[model samples]
Target: QLDDDLVSALKGALSGSLEALILGLMKSTAQYDASELKASMKGLGTDEETLIEIVCSRNNEELAEIKRVYRDMFKKDLEKDVAGDTSGNFAKLLLALVQTRRDEPSNVVDYEKIDEDARALYEAGVKRKGTDVVTWIEIMSQRSVPHLQKVFERYKSYSPYDMKESIRKEVKGDLEKSFLTLVECFENRQLYFASRLNEAMKSKGAKEKVVTRIIVSRCEVDLIKIRTEFKKHFKRSLYQTITEHTKGDYQKALLSLCGGDD
Candidate 1:
């Protein structure tokens, strides 16, 4: 039930990626793990399992270790291998991820880059959610939180607006806030989400979509922190919030997202 729009967007990214790229990868990679390949054949193999696992699992501290070993084992840069095996939108998105590396802290940020990012995000998420999510996920999951914060702060400054208010002012529809919250939470787990949720519960009706967005997108990555955010910000337990606003599959999913910690 993804609908025609979502299907079309995903297909567009697949087509642009070049069949040769996918076909070449589908042949020898045998599950995207480049680690098993000999140094001479590294570029010829896909190694996606190792790559994506590291991308999805490693925080900044661990990612450097993975990067070091990947380069040492392959005898070539990890970036180069990725470039060789992927193309088009998929390549563009994945390269953005591999290049940025992590969300580590930075001394300064460029505001203009944020505008470009906003443009890219608008094009990807609002205009086309399917393929765009792939791209965004690669970048967001790959980059570290500190790096993402710079982009988030810069984005806020460039637009000169808070995401919640901005959404209220500029965008309409239930999903916009959800998407914005995803960007916010991904950017600064400690600051963005808990603050907003607390503010929402106190000042306005708590929006279920905001809670849903964070739970669905980030629960696996940082549920304990999220529960803390809910407690600290709203001054109400997260479980209480869950009971008030949700039930059934969504609630089950959220509880599951806490990953059995609760």
Candidate 2:
């Protein structure tokens, strides 16, 4: 169920700012004036921070309705306005928010990434030079787990050794362990990740990397949902999982994102 507090916040009024009123819009337009923005944002009064939360936080359908309203009211395009209005990670996150589809296009993989992952496994084993333990962790943590599933299948075909086992042999130190957990737990995630993370954290400073990726991403939208899945798959509490694995401010931010006890 949706949190009642968030639901109430969703129902909250807007201020004069474009960001503030846009959430309430069933549809919107580029042609809208300060007055419409005024009426939308007025009583409650909104600002950029609030807009970032609403726009970047909500999913595509909700954002789409707001876009529709913007078009109807202003008679201008929403994408162009958003394109003009935002940039960088905030913009990227917002666009990802707008692009609610999470499925990998079947053709997206083709043969390259498959070959790349396999070649990485067969050759150097680490896939570094930009491809490294950190990169693999981020991809697994952020992208669809199912996509990771496909990569694993391709990897199995590429080398005689299993990908995770190859990483264990090729990569050294905590880095190897981290990537191993990501791949090993990909299939039975809920059953393994938290414990694997705890095991992975046994090495020095390893937890820090995991904390930083999650905390720094500003991935408010759908992030908790990911955590929930992580927990469900790992058969462990995400909070207890993180706490057992990390320490300090980075852990705090990640726990917050996971909606966990800090």
Candidate 3:
């Protein structure tokens, strides 16, 4: 662990985006996630995109740790904070996820349950007149990734559109965004992150916080795979994209975290 005085000195020495990145790096993964969550909800308006991305992408254990750390760091309950900040079904979905009740991934796949869930989702959305947001929220927030993957595959046989398309058709606003993000993370987390990174830099002005969060959070996890996916999808390397969008020490720090060009 870094010493408290040393960490404070480094915090005092650094300024701007570089300080955010460096300080982010010093914390444990759960602590970083907790801080990011707090930062997203701080101030007048909430950053719904950041909240969605972080909440939707994390797994059961990771979320449990984040919720615990969030309370410790902020002296507040993560679930209550989410409920207070968001509204409607979006808040329901986020609160469900923050409960950390998702089943663990296992070698054993329950094909029967998969088919049942696929049917449930299909009936709830495409087959019915009105969408059942509750059913969607329950399945999406509680199922294991591997189970959901199989469910999505089976769902294609029942509905005209895939799960993501179905989500787009069924819901609107932040709820839709959260569901889609969850589906993408389920399908291919690294690829989803690569797409997010590309989107962050592709805008007129780069979304620096999104870029920093993705890079810093994923650096030790699957950044190399994300780089590969970035090149494959965008026809440009993430390193070059960072060079074009950011400047000075911020760019340098990002590039170092990115590891290398694809």
On residues 1-262, what C-alpha lDDT tens digit does candidate 2 reach at each position? 3554653565564322222223323222322222233233334343433344234333334455666666666676555554455554334444454444434335464466656645554544433343344344334444445566767777777667677777666655434444554465456533343343444555675544333323333233344555566566666666777677666654554566566542
- Least well predicted 10-residue stretch by lDDT in candidate 3: 1-10
Q: Candidate 2: where is the Cα deviation over 4 Å? A: 1-120, 123-151, 174-222, 239-262
lDDT of 1: 0.48
With candidate 1 superimposed using the best TM-score fit, by how many Å does residue 154's alpha carbon deviate from the native?
Answer: 9.2
Question: What TM-score would candidate 3 get against the native?
Answer: 0.94
Best by TM-score: 3
Predicted structure 2, TM vs. truth = 0.32
In terms of TM-score, how similar is model 1 to the real structure? 0.34
Candidate order by TM-score, highest to lowest?
3, 1, 2
Clashes of each: 10, 23, 0
> In model 2, how many backbone clashes occur?
23
The residue-by-residue lDDT of candidate 3 on 9-116, one tens digit each, is: 988999978888998998888899999999999988999988999999988888999988998999999999998899989999999999988888988878899999
Poorly placed runs, candidate 1 (over 4 Å): 1-50, 56-61, 101-116, 123-262
lDDT for 39 in candidate 3 is: 91
